[model samples]
Target: MKTYTYRHPEAIEHTGEVPVMDEQGQVILYSQRVYENYLKRTFDKMFDFRYFLKYEVLDSQREMLFTVKKISRRGKLWFEAVEVASKKKYIISYENWRIGLPTLFITDRKLKIQLEKEFEDWSNFLLDEVEIAKWKAEFSEELGEFHMTLQIHENSPIQQPEFFVGICQATLFVGA
Candidate 1:
């Protein structure tokens, strides 16, 4: 399995470029958050309603890899991600509750994935009851930031790993 870490300032609002690094501390991808207008940007900063913003993931060469946009946010958070080259679409739904951890659902045209935070600060992506990926979150008081780690099993069946990373980025943007 390979481990990747993404560390960012612990703030409700994020903008500009954020880096995702490998276990070796090498940046593998950059995620950028963009708002449609100044009003939406200010609203996002003041509240948790991030449906007004969009996210873009770029490679080392600053080439756009994929884009994530909010599709709905009434009771649950829904997002749509499109790969730049293939134009493949992924639908991600997050079910939030007043108690307990939220549940994340990711699906493409055929495959469906269910991820639930069964423990505090830890979540696992399960496909047919088999664990394929693990996600862990830690807060650093010294740096006043949050570090998110994702570990993908070597034999994982998932094809596009970057799409999951993009979903993670969207979750971070919405405080999910």
Candidate 2:
């Protein structure tokens, strides 16, 4: 087998955004795209909160789903109505209620699992058993594909360099 090296004469330089052609010779991908800045200001306002939040929507009538939810509970409660949409959906139409407990289990052991299970059990409660199964299947797929950037801002903050930038790429292709 012949080994290829990038700088050697044996290797071909990769031009950015190589065009992929179908059988009909139609261009499938190009370096250029018509980027519409429409609603960017509106979108920016949505993210105007001090805390960072974003989500990549996998599917819907909306091209990309974006929402900022402020969690509120009526009073001290085990469970609160965070969201209930379409009369049968757990979509984030409301805020997730939570106790003022640290996410990290520094002083509490059951807090993490309890919080997770809260959402899990709540999911079942929101939908019928059959609908829950189907919604979970689709939502799980979306969950796997859904990638978001989040940074927990610290009130007592310190400057830190980004560690992942210019590091590497790991390919994960499990399909034929």
Best by TM-score: 1
Over 4 Å off in model 2, which ranges? 1-50, 58-62, 65-68, 71-96, 99-125, 128-176
Across 1-176, the per-residue lDDT of candidate 2 in tens digits comes to 11110110111111122222223444322211111243543453464421112211111132221111222245422211111122211122212323321121101121121111121222111111121110011113433321111121232121111110000000000000
Whose lDDT is greatest here?
A: 1
Scored against the true structure, residue 154 in model 2 reaches a CA lDDT of: 32
Worst 10 residues of 2 by lDDT: 167-176
In terms of lDDT, the poorest run of 10 residues in model 1 is 167-176
lDDT of 1 by residue, 27-70 (tens): 88887777778988877666575557578888877788988887
TM-score against native, each model:
0.84, 0.19
Regions of candidate 1 where Cα sits further than 4 Å from its true position:
46-49, 73-76, 96-99, 159-161, 173-176
